[model samples]
Target: MSLSYAYLLTQMVIFIPAIESWLRADPHEVLIVTTIEWYERIKASLETVDDPRVIVHAIEVKSKRPGLIAGIQRTTTDHVVLLDDDSIWSLATLQGLLCGLSAGPRVAGVSNIKVNIRMTLPALAPDAPSMFEAMGAGRHDRRAATNTAMAYFCDSQITCYTSETTAYRTEALQRPGFVEHVVEDYWKGKCKLSSGDDGAITRLYQNGRKTGIVVHDECAIEPKSKENTDYLKQILQWSRSEVRQLVRDPYLLLPSHRRH
Candidate 1:
């Protein structure tokens, strides 16, 4: 049987101009999960979409993890799309991501081939480093190294880390073990962590018994401000997350393609 699915947007409220066009292409249900503070406002935005299937859920947790955790918890569809707020998907992009998930029942999720908006141009303007975004982030979005890594994992039958926009089988996430981390993660079985949710989910699918397919060309991301200290802080947070992830699951260092 075909899988039933709904899009679950995280981190930001849905107001992107491009989203209207995207909905025109595939009017699938979209559920935006947010913190309690934005709940009423986000709930009101539901009227913005023509599709009645669209809905919003609110979690008391102030962290972004609540968006993902509460989002998956509220949906009963066979599949859930964990799409970020800053992502831009073309009319065909949503289908493209789903195509990867349709590979087989064993497939847990599908990762999008994400690119940065600066990539819309032939090349990044020479001085992008000083612009609103960091050069490495935009330049690496479609760099050869990233593509090669994806190819190696896909061809080698290894799971790729889904990011930016990914569609996951509901069962894959409903598993008790995976859900626990999403609810609240702990560092070294001691300190509690309410963040690094994106990293945690990626490591789960990448190292889990289930598998995933990588869509080589579809998703694009909005650039961040270089002037914003928030962006710099985010980078620092990611750095710490990497350390915790490696220790939590050493398999991340050399994940095996073979699954039991």
Candidate 2:
């Protein structure tokens, strides 16, 4: 259908401003996918333009992966960009990410933050080095080399950034395996979901799949606030459950990866 392009947004109250940034920044034909509750609260904040380019979907599903992947699948777009509740981007950053995806087939992902090209570390631990650092656990301003495995590995680690604004190509990202990482359930009074999309993508790339990054300094991020304390507790509980299950059967989520 005209080689459509779209943007996916997970919402809460704070992200309304960021959504405005997205609506203005992404190319025409970009769709915004958000929870029904969130859409009800935030949709009105966006000014109505007669432009048929923006479409909104009311998401009933609570899990991040299913809902987001479903949104991507529903889109007629050839390219899809993903954003979280806390990320705000400049027009330049948005264009750069899209252009990076348009670069070539070998590039499966595009990162919006600064990236450190020369470092390696394990996947999934707080101690893991910042995927954007110049070196593992060290910061430097050096530019990264082009198309190296280590360069791709750095891209993989960045796949773990749950709250940061990022975008993806739909054809490459909609695989069933990638959607399996979303975990969701009611923790307290409110329905909640934990994001594991990036982590799963990181695992795929680390397993030798190809991906890429678009480093831009102007892209800024706002921290996500856990407004629902009970939801936070539930997330903690779910994480513990996942760890225990993984320990009992290493293949449950992470395989050949040590608990420590």
Candidate 3:
């Protein structure tokens, strides 16, 4: 019953709470994966962790999809958590995600509400309903259909639900040659043309069933850099193309992209 988990970080600073929460929430073994440059940061971030089940490794991926594929190959755990430095989750949220993993194989992945870290302020704080607006959850934090891309506001209630910090079953991700395909797309510029990690995961989920939000509240994420605005837009367009190609395959195809 060991849950194998991988967390990915780029140029962003790591928040200690996220790691602390992962250590506490990990039902089994946990591994922290990051770029070679962040090795020291990963060690410093784990100072408070008392769990022996946690291990940290350095990966050389310079971009999102490749990093994720490397992390997945490194993990032998039954479950995996792909996360970013900016994505934060609580212990309770992680617990809920683990509980849902027992539901069976068709469930490829799960998302939480991811809010814009920079957008948090008293004056502009989001109410419960508005927080999940982009993700298509009703006021009650209801579950929408899985396997589709949905947007939720980056608020205190639920963050973006982007795979930057998502939980998945290893078999589901390993199937359909998930990591291999992502890497191929990366080399092909599909990953770069799309936004980044989110687009890569969206493409992955299109090949499988991405469950609705199960974690309590949501995870917080920062907005992309102003300098990378064009990059994000290109990522969006590339994501559309990748989804179309991936979904057309007979073995791994999802029903269709349902707009939430």
Candidate 4:
């Protein structure tokens, strides 16, 4: 029952809180993998943690996928928990993930539902309506409906596992070509993909003989939201990934072999 927590860190401010929360979950070890530049800048802050279980690994490679793969390779635990730098999790969430994996040997991975914080603007005056309210009279209703529809679709059809807050049996992760399979874009004939590692990993495990689970608990992870230009860029990147997945692996769209 050894557990290793691995985080691919980009922003130190957000990652610090995420790491602190994960530490409270009491994993056997914590691996923080980041770029060498970031590691040098945040070395002092990391040194203050003073935990023998925490190990910082800096790589010359500057991509998230490589850093994550490197960190996973260094894990010495039977179970590995993959986390994004901006994701915040609770101890209960950690336990729930482990419990889900413990349900059966064929369970390759388990991930919790994710909740994104809605971005809103402050009210201009005491009598002013809130930003969401100002969107229109029925905007809230439409938003609620959309949320429900997406949630239903995710739970019922898709492989609801994302790297933001996922736990995997190390055996599944150690499968031959797992890392390269996730990071490479075969459809577009690319050496490396800029994003969509989560989707790739989910599809990989789902296509295997084993199954994956999405824990229905309060183990919701909150990832930092992008704003303005960054938000648009993020949306574009996700859209590209989705298109690529659909084109390359249409079976993911089928409603089969998913565990809730």
- Highest-TM-score candidate: 4
Lowest lDDT 10-mer window, candidate 4?
Answer: 135-144
Using TM-score, rank the candidates from best to worst.
4, 1, 3, 2
Of the two candidates 3 and 4, the one with more favorable TM-score, higher being better, is 4
Question: How many clashes (backbone N, Cα, C below 3 Å) per candidate?
Answer: 1, 0, 14, 0
Q: Please report, in order, the local distance difference test score of every candidate based on alpha carbons.
A: 0.57, 0.48, 0.51, 0.64
Where is model 3 more than 4 Å wrong at Cα?
1-13, 48-50, 115-121, 124-161, 186-195, 207-210, 215-260
Q: Candidate 3, residues 1-260: lDDT per residue as tens digits?
A: 23333444333334455555566654567666666887787677566666677677777755655656656777677778777553455546666666555565656666655443323445355532233232222211222222222323211112123554567777766776665556555434443332345545555564335454553444322222222345345445545654654454333322233322
**Which residue pairs clash in candidate 4?**
none
* Per-residue lDDT of model 1, residues 1-260, tens digit only: 11221223333343544345355546456676666677676666655655666666666766666567667777687877776555566666667656767877767766655555454544456644454354436443543344446446544233234345567788888888877766567877787776566567766766434444444554333423335566567556655775676577665335453344
- Model 4, global lDDT: 0.64
lDDT digits (tens) for residues 145-225 of candidate 4: 433443366443233356567788887888899877866646557446857777777677664344444445367665554
Q: Candidate 4: TM-score?
A: 0.77
lDDT accuracy of residue 212 in candidate 3: 46
Which structure is stronger by TM-score: 2 or 3? Answer: 3
After superposing candidate 2 on the true structure, give the runs of residues whose Cα lies further than 4 Å from its correct spot: 1-13, 47-51, 114-163, 175-194, 219-260
Candidate 2 lDDT, tens digit per residue, 115-198? Answer: 332334355555554432312213122212322323454433232323245556676666665554443332242644354455
